[model samples]
Target: MEIREDDLTGQQIIALLREHLENMHEITPPGSVHALDLERLRSREITFWTAWEGDDLLGCGALKELDPTSGEIKSMRTPAAHRRRGIASKLLEHIIEVARQRGYTHLYLETGAFPAFAPARALYQRYGFEYRGPFGDYADDPNSTFMVKTLVG
Candidate 1:
Protein backbone atom coordinates (compact mmCIF):
# COMPACT_ATOMS: atom_id res chain seq x y z
CA MET A 1 0.00 0.00 0.00
CA GLU A 2 1.13 3.53 -0.69
CA ILE A 3 0.42 6.19 1.90
CA ARG A 4 0.19 9.67 0.47
CA GLU A 5 -0.31 13.13 1.86
CA ASP A 6 -3.57 14.31 0.40
CA ASP A 7 -5.63 17.41 0.19
CA LEU A 8 -9.35 16.98 0.95
CA THR A 9 -9.95 17.22 -2.82
CA GLY A 10 -8.98 13.59 -3.43
CA GLN A 11 -12.27 11.86 -4.22
CA GLN A 12 -11.35 8.45 -2.82
CA ILE A 13 -10.08 9.96 0.39
CA ILE A 14 -13.15 12.16 0.73
CA ALA A 15 -15.46 9.19 0.23
CA LEU A 16 -13.59 7.11 2.77
CA LEU A 17 -13.64 9.95 5.30
CA ARG A 18 -17.32 10.65 4.71
CA GLU A 19 -18.08 6.99 5.29
CA HIS A 20 -16.23 7.05 8.59
CA LEU A 21 -18.00 10.16 9.82
CA GLU A 22 -21.42 8.81 8.84
CA ASN A 23 -20.72 5.52 10.61
CA MET A 24 -19.46 7.23 13.75
CA HIS A 25 -22.77 9.02 14.10
CA GLU A 26 -24.40 5.61 14.47
CA ILE A 27 -21.96 4.20 17.02
CA THR A 28 -21.56 7.37 19.05
CA PRO A 29 -23.97 9.79 20.58
CA PRO A 30 -24.54 12.85 18.41
CA GLY A 31 -23.21 15.46 20.81
CA SER A 32 -20.11 13.49 21.81
CA VAL A 33 -18.94 12.50 18.38
CA HIS A 34 -15.81 14.39 17.30
CA ALA A 35 -15.60 13.20 13.71
CA LEU A 36 -14.55 15.82 11.16
CA ASP A 37 -16.33 16.67 7.94
CA LEU A 38 -14.67 17.50 4.61
CA GLU A 39 -14.86 21.26 5.09
CA ARG A 40 -13.38 21.02 8.55
CA LEU A 41 -10.46 19.01 7.21
CA ARG A 42 -10.03 21.43 4.38
CA SER A 43 -8.87 24.02 6.91
CA ARG A 44 -5.17 24.65 7.37
CA GLU A 45 -5.13 23.52 10.99
CA ILE A 46 -4.04 19.93 10.38
CA THR A 47 -1.91 17.79 8.10
CA PHE A 48 -3.83 14.79 6.71
CA TRP A 49 -2.89 11.62 4.90
CA THR A 50 -4.61 8.83 3.05
CA ALA A 51 -3.40 5.29 2.69
CA TRP A 52 -4.12 3.78 -0.69
CA GLU A 53 -3.51 0.68 -2.74
CA GLY A 54 -3.57 1.69 -6.38
CA ASP A 55 -7.09 3.10 -6.68
CA ASP A 56 -8.41 1.66 -3.42
CA LEU A 57 -8.46 3.82 -0.35
CA LEU A 58 -7.32 1.72 2.58
CA GLY A 59 -7.56 4.24 5.39
CA CYS A 60 -6.66 7.74 6.55
CA GLY A 61 -5.31 9.64 9.57
CA ALA A 62 -4.08 13.11 10.50
CA LEU A 63 -1.81 15.01 12.85
CA LYS A 64 -2.81 18.32 14.35
CA GLU A 65 -0.16 20.47 15.93
CA LEU A 66 -1.28 21.25 19.44
CA ASP A 67 1.74 23.25 20.48
CA PRO A 68 5.42 23.55 19.74
CA THR A 69 6.28 20.06 20.96
CA SER A 70 2.95 18.29 20.97
CA GLY A 71 0.62 16.89 18.33
CA GLU A 72 -2.74 15.20 18.41
CA ILE A 73 -3.82 12.28 16.27
CA LYS A 74 -6.99 13.10 14.42
CA SER A 75 -9.45 11.35 12.12
CA MET A 76 -8.04 7.84 12.26
CA ARG A 77 -10.31 5.61 10.27
CA THR A 78 -9.94 2.39 8.33
CA PRO A 79 -12.38 1.66 5.54
CA ALA A 80 -14.76 -1.10 6.62
CA ALA A 81 -13.80 -3.19 3.60
CA HIS A 82 -10.12 -2.71 4.42
CA ARG A 83 -10.21 -3.67 8.08
CA ARG A 84 -7.75 -6.29 9.42
CA ARG A 85 -5.40 -5.73 6.50
CA GLY A 86 -2.98 -3.57 8.57
CA ILE A 87 -4.02 -0.46 6.73
CA ALA A 88 -4.81 1.44 9.92
CA SER A 89 -1.65 0.15 11.50
CA LYS A 90 0.47 1.31 8.59
CA LEU A 91 -1.14 4.72 8.59
CA LEU A 92 -0.66 5.07 12.34
CA GLU A 93 2.97 4.04 12.16
CA HIS A 94 3.55 6.55 9.44
CA ILE A 95 1.93 9.30 11.49
CA ILE A 96 3.99 8.53 14.57
CA GLU A 97 7.22 8.41 12.63
CA VAL A 98 6.49 11.68 10.94
CA ALA A 99 5.51 13.34 14.20
CA ARG A 100 8.70 12.23 15.92
CA GLN A 101 10.87 13.36 13.04
CA ARG A 102 9.13 16.68 13.06
CA GLY A 103 10.22 17.22 16.69
CA TYR A 104 7.00 16.49 18.45
CA THR A 105 7.85 15.40 21.98
CA HIS A 106 4.47 13.84 22.67
CA LEU A 107 1.57 12.51 20.68
CA TYR A 108 -1.96 12.41 22.01
CA LEU A 109 -5.43 11.34 20.90
CA GLU A 110 -9.02 11.10 21.99
CA THR A 111 -11.27 8.19 20.99
CA GLY A 112 -14.60 6.79 22.00
CA ALA A 113 -14.90 4.77 25.18
CA PHE A 114 -17.67 2.55 23.93
CA PRO A 115 -17.34 -1.08 22.87
CA ALA A 116 -17.30 0.12 19.28
CA PHE A 117 -13.84 1.53 19.96
CA ALA A 118 -12.18 -1.62 21.25
CA PRO A 119 -10.14 -2.28 18.15
CA ALA A 120 -8.93 1.30 18.04
CA ARG A 121 -8.05 1.22 21.76
CA ALA A 122 -6.03 -1.93 21.14
CA LEU A 123 -4.22 -0.36 18.23
CA TYR A 124 -3.16 2.61 20.35
CA GLN A 125 -2.08 0.36 23.20
CA ARG A 126 0.20 -1.56 20.87
CA TYR A 127 1.93 1.70 20.06
CA GLY A 128 2.58 2.49 23.76
CA PHE A 129 -0.05 5.17 24.27
CA GLU A 130 -1.14 5.12 27.88
CA TYR A 131 -4.34 6.46 29.31
CA ARG A 132 -4.27 10.03 30.52
CA GLY A 133 -6.55 12.65 31.92
CA PRO A 134 -8.28 15.03 29.56
CA PHE A 135 -5.97 17.42 27.78
CA GLY A 136 -6.39 20.55 25.70
CA ASP A 137 -9.90 21.91 25.96
CA TYR A 138 -11.26 18.52 26.92
CA ALA A 139 -13.03 18.07 30.22
CA ASP A 140 -13.63 14.96 32.30
CA ASP A 141 -15.72 13.20 29.72
CA PRO A 142 -16.85 9.65 30.38
CA ASN A 143 -17.58 9.18 26.71
CA SER A 144 -14.01 9.89 25.71
CA THR A 145 -10.81 7.96 26.36
CA PHE A 146 -7.77 10.20 26.28
CA MET A 147 -4.32 8.77 25.57
CA VAL A 148 -0.82 10.03 25.04
CA LYS A 149 2.52 8.64 23.89
CA THR A 150 5.82 10.29 24.70
CA LEU A 151 8.06 10.59 21.65
CA VAL A 152 11.17 11.84 23.34
CA GLY A 153 14.47 10.78 21.82
Candidate 2:
Protein backbone atom coordinates (compact mmCIF):
# COMPACT_ATOMS: atom_id res chain seq x y z
CA MET A 1 0.00 0.00 0.00
CA GLU A 2 1.07 3.55 -0.72
CA ILE A 3 0.81 5.92 2.19
CA ARG A 4 1.33 9.65 1.60
CA GLU A 5 0.26 13.11 2.68
CA ASP A 6 -3.25 13.97 1.58
CA ASP A 7 -4.81 17.32 0.82
CA LEU A 8 -8.25 16.12 1.99
CA THR A 9 -9.91 17.26 -1.22
CA GLY A 10 -10.50 13.96 -2.90
CA GLN A 11 -14.03 12.60 -2.90
CA GLN A 12 -12.88 9.28 -1.55
CA ILE A 13 -11.19 10.89 1.42
CA ILE A 14 -14.09 13.22 2.04
CA ALA A 15 -16.48 10.31 1.98
CA LEU A 16 -14.23 8.30 4.26
CA LEU A 17 -13.94 11.14 6.73
CA ARG A 18 -17.67 11.63 6.69
CA GLU A 19 -18.10 7.98 7.43
CA HIS A 20 -15.60 8.30 10.24
CA LEU A 21 -17.53 11.13 11.80
CA GLU A 22 -20.79 9.26 11.41
CA ASN A 23 -19.31 6.22 13.09
CA MET A 24 -17.96 8.30 15.93
CA HIS A 25 -21.32 9.90 16.50
CA GLU A 26 -23.01 6.55 16.40
CA ILE A 27 -20.81 5.00 19.04
CA THR A 28 -19.72 7.94 21.19
CA PRO A 29 -21.80 10.33 23.23
CA PRO A 30 -22.48 13.78 21.79
CA GLY A 31 -20.04 15.70 23.98
CA SER A 32 -17.46 12.94 24.06
CA VAL A 33 -17.08 12.63 20.32
CA HIS A 34 -13.85 14.46 19.83
CA ALA A 35 -13.35 13.54 16.22
CA LEU A 36 -12.70 16.54 14.06
CA ASP A 37 -14.72 17.50 11.07
CA LEU A 38 -13.30 18.13 7.61
CA GLU A 39 -12.71 21.80 8.24
CA ARG A 40 -10.98 21.16 11.55
CA LEU A 41 -8.80 18.49 10.02
CA ARG A 42 -7.80 21.01 7.37
CA SER A 43 -6.30 23.34 9.94
CA ARG A 44 -2.69 24.35 9.57
CA GLU A 45 -1.64 22.47 12.69
CA ILE A 46 -2.66 19.11 11.29
CA THR A 47 -1.00 16.77 8.82
CA PHE A 48 -3.26 14.17 7.22
CA TRP A 49 -2.41 10.99 5.33
CA THR A 50 -4.18 8.28 3.41
CA ALA A 51 -3.28 4.70 2.53
CA TRP A 52 -4.00 3.45 -0.93
CA GLU A 53 -3.64 0.28 -2.94
CA GLY A 54 -3.77 1.30 -6.56
CA ASP A 55 -7.22 2.79 -7.06
CA ASP A 56 -8.49 1.67 -3.68
CA LEU A 57 -8.39 3.90 -0.63
CA LEU A 58 -7.55 1.68 2.30
CA GLY A 59 -7.55 4.07 5.26
CA CYS A 60 -6.40 7.39 6.66
CA GLY A 61 -4.93 9.04 9.79
CA ALA A 62 -3.56 12.40 10.90
CA LEU A 63 -1.13 14.03 13.32
CA LYS A 64 -1.96 17.33 14.95
CA GLU A 65 0.79 19.45 16.44
CA LEU A 66 -0.40 20.48 19.87
CA ASP A 67 2.72 22.35 20.88
CA PRO A 68 6.47 22.43 20.30
CA THR A 69 7.15 19.05 21.84
CA SER A 70 3.81 17.25 21.69
CA GLY A 71 1.30 16.11 19.08
CA GLU A 72 -2.07 14.39 18.87
CA ILE A 73 -3.14 11.55 16.65
CA LYS A 74 -6.45 12.02 14.86
CA SER A 75 -8.83 10.56 12.32
CA MET A 76 -7.46 7.03 12.33
CA ARG A 77 -9.81 4.74 10.42
CA THR A 78 -9.84 1.78 8.08
CA PRO A 79 -12.95 0.89 6.12
CA ALA A 80 -14.85 -2.17 7.23
CA ALA A 81 -13.90 -3.99 4.06
CA HIS A 82 -10.21 -3.36 4.78
CA ARG A 83 -10.05 -4.21 8.45
CA ARG A 84 -7.20 -6.42 9.80
CA ARG A 85 -5.04 -5.61 6.79
CA GLY A 86 -2.48 -3.56 8.75
CA ILE A 87 -3.60 -0.31 7.14
CA ALA A 88 -4.33 1.34 10.47
CA SER A 89 -1.06 0.02 11.90
CA LYS A 90 0.94 1.36 8.97
CA LEU A 91 -0.70 4.74 9.19
CA LEU A 92 -0.11 4.82 12.95
CA GLU A 93 3.56 3.86 12.58
CA HIS A 94 3.93 6.57 9.97
CA ILE A 95 2.38 9.16 12.26
CA ILE A 96 4.65 8.16 15.13
CA GLU A 97 7.74 8.40 12.94
CA VAL A 98 6.70 11.81 11.69
CA ALA A 99 6.12 12.99 15.24
CA ARG A 100 9.61 11.79 16.14
CA GLN A 101 11.08 13.52 13.14
CA ARG A 102 9.40 16.74 14.18
CA GLY A 103 11.11 16.47 17.60
CA TYR A 104 7.92 15.76 19.47
CA THR A 105 8.68 14.22 22.87
CA HIS A 106 5.15 12.95 23.39
CA LEU A 107 2.20 11.73 21.34
CA TYR A 108 -1.30 11.90 22.70
CA LEU A 109 -4.72 10.69 21.59
CA GLU A 110 -8.29 10.42 22.84
CA THR A 111 -10.63 7.67 21.84
CA GLY A 112 -14.00 6.36 22.96
CA ALA A 113 -14.34 4.41 26.17
CA PHE A 114 -17.07 2.16 24.83
CA PRO A 115 -16.58 -1.49 24.05
CA ALA A 116 -16.83 -0.57 20.39
CA PHE A 117 -13.52 1.18 20.89
CA ALA A 118 -11.68 -1.73 22.47
CA PRO A 119 -9.88 -2.61 19.25
CA ALA A 120 -8.67 0.94 18.85
CA ARG A 121 -7.53 1.08 22.44
CA ALA A 122 -5.71 -2.18 22.00
CA LEU A 123 -3.96 -0.90 18.90
CA TYR A 124 -2.69 2.16 20.72
CA GLN A 125 -1.60 0.04 23.66
CA ARG A 126 0.35 -2.21 21.32
CA TYR A 127 2.22 0.86 20.15
CA GLY A 128 3.32 1.68 23.72
CA PHE A 129 0.73 4.30 24.54
CA GLU A 130 -0.41 4.19 28.17
CA TYR A 131 -3.64 5.35 29.68
CA ARG A 132 -3.47 8.88 31.00
CA GLY A 133 -5.70 11.60 32.33
CA PRO A 134 -7.07 14.23 30.03
CA PHE A 135 -4.64 16.52 28.25
CA GLY A 136 -4.83 19.62 26.13
CA ASP A 137 -8.36 21.07 26.15
CA TYR A 138 -9.89 17.82 27.28
CA ALA A 139 -11.73 17.29 30.59
CA ASP A 140 -12.47 14.19 32.58
CA ASP A 141 -15.25 12.35 30.77
CA PRO A 142 -16.23 8.76 31.34
CA ASN A 143 -17.00 8.44 27.66
CA SER A 144 -13.42 9.25 26.76
CA THR A 145 -10.20 7.32 27.09
CA PHE A 146 -7.03 9.39 26.93
CA MET A 147 -3.62 7.94 26.20
CA VAL A 148 -0.08 9.20 25.82
CA LYS A 149 3.26 7.85 24.71
CA THR A 150 6.64 9.30 25.66
CA LEU A 151 8.83 9.34 22.62
CA VAL A 152 12.39 8.18 23.24
CA GLY A 153 15.18 8.66 20.79
Best by TM-score: 2
Candidate 2 residue lDDT tens string, 1-153: 999999999999999999999999988878889999999999999999999999999999999999999999999999999999888999999999999999999999999999999999999999999999999999999999999999975
The candidate that wins on lDDT is 2
Q: Show where candidate 1 strays beyond 4 Å.
A: none
Deviation (Å) of 128 in candidate 2: 0.3
Output the worst ten-in-a-row residue range by lDDT, candidate 2: 24-33
lDDT of 1 at 43: 69
Report the lDDT tens digits of candidate 1 across residue range 1-153: 998898889778877888888888988886788877888876676999998788888889999889889999999988778899988899999999999988999999999999989999999999999999999988778889999999995
Model 1 gets an lDDT of 0.90
Error of 1 at 1 (Å): 0.8
lDDT of 1 at 28: 87
